[model samples]
Target: MRIIINTGKGGVGKSTISALTSINISKRLKTLLISSDLAHSLSDLFAIKLTANPTRICENLYALEINPIIESAKAWQNLNSYLRELVKNNSLNDIQVEELLLFPGLEDVFSLLKILEIYKEGKYEVLVVDCGPSAETISLLSTGEKLNNLADTLVPLVKRFNSLLGGFIEKKTEVKKPKDIVFDEFVGLAKKLYELEKILMNPEITSVRFVTKASKVISNETFRASTLMNMYGFLTDCVYINMLYPEEIKNSSYDNLYLEERENVDRIEEFYPDKRVFKIYMKANEVIGLKELESLNEEIFSKIYLEEFFTACRTFDIKSEGASKIIEIDFKFASDKEVDVRRIGNDLELSYLNFKRRFKLPDTLSSRKISSYSIEDEKLKIVMDYD
Candidate 1:
């Protein structure tokens, strides 16, 4: 199955692009379009209602708005019920048991897990995802790999400890199984997760299409999103530069906002010379409902260059060196001044002017003490020292 992820600056017509693309693709292939953003308007765009399940919209199209609470209840209800029962029966603190259910990003993680469920059913040709804004979307995808590894290591230890504790605490009682089934379930979950990861990392089967507006706030954000996704092995296929001002206003000489917006388009193209970028003229009316969305799709292809698929020719590497790990990030544009850097616990944060990003240490490097850092060859070098 093919997976297409659309993410860009908010208010850049992302929902329009997602709706239009999914509808167009569905005419020729079976497609499942999913929106993970909290402010989802897929229902509004299609002029039909949507829920957590894959609701059939037309002949070949299905839509879903991922509801994490609903998904968690469906996927983990058995496990959670067992845990809650065990804790309550054992007289554990009520607050502690309740708090255990409140893990951060459980919803985001569970949303991704649902993809595996659909893929396992073996029913669709393409999976189109309208993910959250850049930060949360990338984080949502990367969390699975880290979690899969964590489950692998922790499940065994947890099973052993549960068995030892249960045996020692109640010698007269019948020996209870260590809930080893949970660990087995985790293994199954991890296997499915790993398959999804493999699919995303493969450029041939997966691609990211960015929908961006030509204004400043979103223009800069699109640039950063492009670099960040490329750094993480998600291949960006093409940039859909949406909402361009029409040149008809030039005769009236009312304002230069249109001219300024035109220049932003040129600037974005210059930043990524190696990739294909497509543009769309600003609509006369607001884009809403199925009719306008269909018009938006019709306007796309005539201006689009089919040969210019998204391409990535740069690499960012983070390597371990003794106690510290060195990160080397290369960007197409040069920094005019010293780039800003800050270390917060195990995460290294970097910023240049208004652009900022944070990265955590790899498992192999997080435990080491960072001795020193430097920038050379357009790469950040970090030396690690043993305590």
Candidate 2:
């Protein structure tokens, strides 16, 4: 199954683009479009009320606005109930306990869990995700990996607590520590998270599309987003400059806006030179409903297969070059400017003007020094010194 995720600045009409893209996909494949954001627009866009349960939009097309809180309640019910029973003296109501049980930004993770759950059902050919804003979505895509790491450390402590609670804590009610039930649930969640990372990081299974307006600020944010997308090992295939003004209009007062917006696209093209860039012209009226979305889809994606619209280059790879080693990365999005590179022991840090990620190199490569870096065939090759 193919997963297409759309994210951008909060008001770049990403939902509209997602609607259009999913409508187009549903024409050829069984598709489900999910609004995974807290503030939803799919209902307004589709002009139909929706719930966590998938609602049919058209033949072979389904859409829903997922409540991550609700998903979390369902998934973590045993754990939450056990905790509440264990600490009944804490003056917190069920609602307050529910809120306290939720980790910061865990709703985002729950949103992904929702995606993973549906993806495993084997019903749909494609799942189109209308993600939250770009920054938050970045956090969402990478949260699985980070949370898994945290779980590895936290699970043992939880087991110890479960043992202590079983012996010492007086049970006010029939509820126990729930170690078996909790661990089973935890294992189930961990499995889902592993699948989540596996699917999201796989290039062939997932494609991320960024939508932005044609302006310097928004385009630059999109550029930084592209860089982060690479850092987290997610694939970014399309960058859409939405709501672009046409070159011709009768107003001389708006000439400068038009010229600057034109330059904005040029800058974005140079920024994302390798990726397919799409320009969405400003429409006279709001593009809503399946009819209008179908019309726009025909106007936009007429030339090639929808699959052709997605592309992702290598993010990070290592290889042996003679006696030395090399790290190959797709820094094409940040290649035009000075990218800061530094090494401290086995950790390598690559920072563009604004964003970067530090990586822990392998133990075998710890003795090797960073010799040099150069862009060869659109890849940033960082060579390690053997001597």
Candidate 3:
């Protein structure tokens, strides 16, 4: 099983949750924990020096922090060199060429590649990933499909153009044509991304745990993040709200603070009614080292079955009713009053409270008109008629 811990904002105890979860899993099963964040803190959290290579932390636990510079040198030097040459040949300055050669999501791509490599090894029973901040994590998860699409559409066109213009361009600018190795590199990347996509989309093998704090800013970002994850077909099993004040401090000097936290907690529950929400109170001492992390893990997830905690909710499905097709959305734990639906081009946007989920309509449904829509049995059924 692979678990990814993610959050929209930083300093929300995401790394803490990931470490404790890994420790808990390692207690009973062999587990590998990976930090995909560029600004890594897993080593600090564990109080042990770590590197890009996996280091055995204990009997059944292993950990690694992805160093993008090292990983890029290992897996992306050829690709980067090709891009640099291409840019330099275009009459661009050295600074401009260098900037272009440093691809935006190369690190994220390498991170997924690393995960795929470890997962395929089949040496560990559980894999826990401490993902980067929300935007980068989303980009990393979406990179595979984007790269595959580019390979299918842009790569062949570029290759053909390069072949046709090689001699002419070389004579004009004294630039060398790109070798076959560059195209081979592109093909290799595409294949790896395709494999990673399959593993990420498989709910039985992977699940995402979203972490946030009980505040307006974090709560709002959490909703948007969860909606986007669902859009990409990633299953979010739970939402962890950390650093909550304990009830004992309710009427103390922190009464107002507790009230605000309570309100935010309620708001989160209302927003993500279907997800399991776990609140971890602020610890008396800083949570560090294996012993403290293990205790924290027990406090948060002692009776919880990590493997069986969440079954991915089937969000939508297509069905046949007589000669027409119907699109059914499962809005379990939600009500008609809570949902507002609208259509934008070929996409349907469903909003509940402050959370919005958008679904792209298939060609069959996009060409047809909505005949009727009804909410029944915790489902929003939209009947589509043949155009």
TM-score of 1: 0.74
TM-score of each: 0.74, 0.83, 0.82
Runs of candidate 2 exceeding 4 Å displacement? 86-94, 157-188, 307-309, 332-387
**Better structure of 1 and 2 per lDDT:** 2
What residue pairs are clashing in model 3? none
lDDT of 2 by residue, 1-387 (tens): 898899999999999988887888887899999999899999888888989999999988999999877888877877877787766877878788777778676888788888988988989999999998998898778666555554666776877787878645547544554666886687567667767887988888988889998888898888778777876678888888999987675267888898888888899888776678889899999976777787888999765455443555667778997888998767655663567678965677776664555556788788888898876776677899877
Give each model's whole-structure lDDT: 0.71, 0.80, 0.77
lDDT per residue, candidate 3, 110-210, as tens digits? 78888888888888888889988876787678777767766877888888988899778988987777876787688778778878887987877888888
Least well predicted 10-residue stretch by lDDT in candidate 3: 351-360
Q: List, residue by residue over 1-387, the lDDT tens digit for candidate 1.
A: 778888877777778778877877876789899988878889888878899889998889899998876666665655777677656666678666655764567667777777777777779988888887877777776665666665767877887887778676546664434466766766766666667876776777777888888877787878776656654556776788887877787656745887788788888887766677778887777777767766666667544433233565434566665545566665434352545666667766666544445556666666766666555654455565457
